[model samples]
Target: MTTDQWVIPFYQKQFKWLRDAEAEMANYLQIEANNIEEQIGIEFNSMLDIGAGIGSIARALDARGIAMTTLELVPDLVEAARRRSPKSIDIHLGDFYTYTFPKQFDVVSYFDGFGIGTDEDQLNLLKRMKSWVKDDGSLLIDIYHPNYWRTIAAGQKMKIDDAERIYSFDEEHCRMIDSWWHNEHPEEIVTQSLRCYTVDEASSMCEKAGLTITGIFPGGAMDFDNWTYKETAPLSGCLSYRIKLTKTI
Candidate 1:
């Protein structure tokens, strides 16, 4: 299935558990906010979050006195964010590829949901994001790492409450596929496919889109056997990597 066809249903179904995990979500968002600050090396005054799941990150940054705006494509997620977030945050419901903002921001961030479509499609989005940042500002994005995904064995399964997820990789295309189903209805499955990129590949895409990669930070991974998450890992061993970029002059 295409990205537009799978994205909404995949996330909506997979993240249903998030609604009840407010405290845990808050802690994660706090760490994400701290990472943004540390990686960017600036006390940014304004930020725009793309694919901002439930505005959790926006809320976290907003609490730190930053003006936050969020763009999300899911209707349910947008409504949830509005209901829970403070009025100061500007939340928009639209596709980042087609949506336009009235003003540029000091920083733009996209976490966890970066690889969606073809390489050209990703490059197009990067070019659009560049226009949303002020000339002197930076953009921070989390890129899925191909190396880590390559290590996941096909048919790897995990059960969470009533739901189960199967992880697999598309070696030829370098994509990660996540399939989810309810234990009661094993016949029905919804999946999300994301393209993975190495740091060098990501750098080339950024350069072509008129952005320069200034920094790279390795992101953590999940130990499925122990059901625990490691907060830090080497670049080749991490689940993903965060990149800091600036508009090329």
Candidate 2:
């Protein structure tokens, strides 16, 4: 319904949602919440999952008796989420940056969907997200590390089910593209792009957004099933941050 982002219209009528592994991905977020609770010692009273896809994280949290509001850009996916999610979850379908949430949240999360726009645009989003966060609420986001993305060779292609996907990184534009099309209907191709970012860049954005970073979990440490966060990671590859954002003076 909203033409907020360039990719929104393409995804509105694309193939039936992501060929992604949703259940397993939800499990990872569950562990992440567990890890955060262990360290922060605060139960998430409410959460706003930005760019929520199929309400995976919402479902995971709902199972644990947590109240959550999920926002998604694509209408089809939002409809799918509405059909599958519990009545407890508050689902909103619109532009996340512009939509006004009804209440503040103890946590705001963006999973693997942090770098969809330019750096300044991203910082502006952070400022908007901050307005919805409670005074002590935390912001957990996963960002694409520049070092790891550089290692991936461009023009890589793969087939999933009946659809084939080609992935490439544009070094000059600093954006990564995932283009897809069905083998039987190669004529109808669709592509989605994301602007990549580094920790330093994200930090600067956070500062400009009037947010404080309490923790930074880099690399594979974000894989909840595999590792626990420890605040230290070399630029090995693919980093994520479980940052605790707070307001500045």
Candidate 3:
């Protein structure tokens, strides 16, 4: 499929909210940006935003005077992010897993886009992404919580705008599948998979990739929604987590 074929088109429309992100999601990100900076220590000079969906976090950080570069998989969104961001920032159109940086960055962030691939793809990408970070720089990524899947599963259909999509659970592979009508041609169908992982499972995957977890932040930056360290038990209730990681143990 073409770059703007299926998923890109859906995002192109769904992320229209991102065009005015400074006015839309700024308040939410602003409330926690200071805390995130303090926790990591030292303000970022150079940063890489992987899967920078329309530069949501990139623009937000740039607004604060941090130098930013975005790597987006979609050419259309990369064009959009470029148009929306300040002239100083650079936006690269490529996949993060194979793209090489001329030098390491002070921070490497992937956000919600971390869960876009399969289980092996997720692990391999995380392993490769570690090399992009400076020795002690942070890696911020989020995964959709597995607990949320158990409660809401199978045959659930919803119309996002006018397009209809169905949700199905794959018990054998333990992945959630969303099948929706094509963005350009509603008569055609498209499928996307979202892998859900418990906090412990995700942390273990990080450990395997040579990353050390420094902290976990709540989804939406709300106190009631948070993910903490778990030994063997699965994380429940939380829908997601903002994991902060470092390259060296």
Candidate 4:
């Protein structure tokens, strides 16, 4: 199946739990919004969140008086976001790969969802995203670190309530694979794969897309032994990193 078609079922099954946890996820989303603000290093009058899941971050930023718009691919998530968000937040339901946006924004943030298809697909999306940013605006994207994913690719397994999750990696392609299934329905499994990139590789790709990297903030690391997460870590040790990009001019 194509990346777009497969992502629907994968994400629908993967994030189904988020449908009921909007209130519980508020604090986390607020922190994410704060991090985005700090990374931007300036006030933003308007923002667009691509691949917005349930619009939590949009609501968090909107609460802070920043006008927010969101684009999401999943119909269920789009409806949930619309239901949870205020009428002022423009929540559009469409694929970022083909959607037509009405205007540009001061900042465009894409959190946790990148590298869906081929390398060329990623480059194409970056070019499209650049077009949506105002000349002086910024783009913030979270990129999975290749080294970190490589270290954890030993088919680690976890049990969440009655469901089981298996994490593996494609060393050949530098992709992270996550699969999930309920214990009672072990035969039925849903999976998603995300391509990981080194900071240097991302820089080269961004440059080709007419964007320049301004800053990179390392994301947290998961401590498998303690089953906890560290809020900050060096890029070499972090699970992912957030890159702040601006127009190449």
Candidates in order: C-alpha RMSD to true structure: 1.7, 4.6, 5.5, 1.6
Model 4 per-residue lDDT tens digits across residues 38-105: 99999889999999988888898999999999999888889888888899899999878888887999
Model 2 spans with C-alpha error above 4 angstroms: 1-5, 9-29, 32-41, 219-235, 239-242
Per-residue accuracy of model 1 over 20-81 as CA lDDT, tens digit each: 67676777878888889999997789999999988888999999999999999988889889
Kindly report which residue pairs in candidate 2 clash with one another: 219-239
Decide which is better by TM-score, 1 or 3.
1
**lDDT (tens digit, per residue) of candidate 3 on 1-249:** 123244565565455422353566677667556655765677778888888877867776777888898898877788878888888787899866677888888888777755665677778888878988989688888777755555544666666554667777766666667677744566766676677787788889998889988887656321212323331223354556678898755
Relative to the true structure, candidate 2 has a C-alpha RMSD (angstroms) of: 4.6
Q: Which ten residues in a row have the lowest lDDT in candidate 2?
A: 221-230
Ordering by lDDT: 1, 4, 2, 3
- Candidate 3 residues lying further than 4 Å off, grouped into runs, are 1-23, 32-42, 153-156, 182-186, 220-235
For 151-242, candidate 2 gives per-residue lDDT tens digits of: 54356566767678776777897777778787888898878777777767767888989987777766453333343444456655544444
In model 3, the worst 10-residue window by lDDT is: 222-231
**lDDT for model 3, on a 0 to 1 scale?**
0.70
Candidate 4 stretches with Cα past 4 Å from truth are 17-19
Clash count in backbone of candidate 3: 0
lDDT of 1 at 233: 88
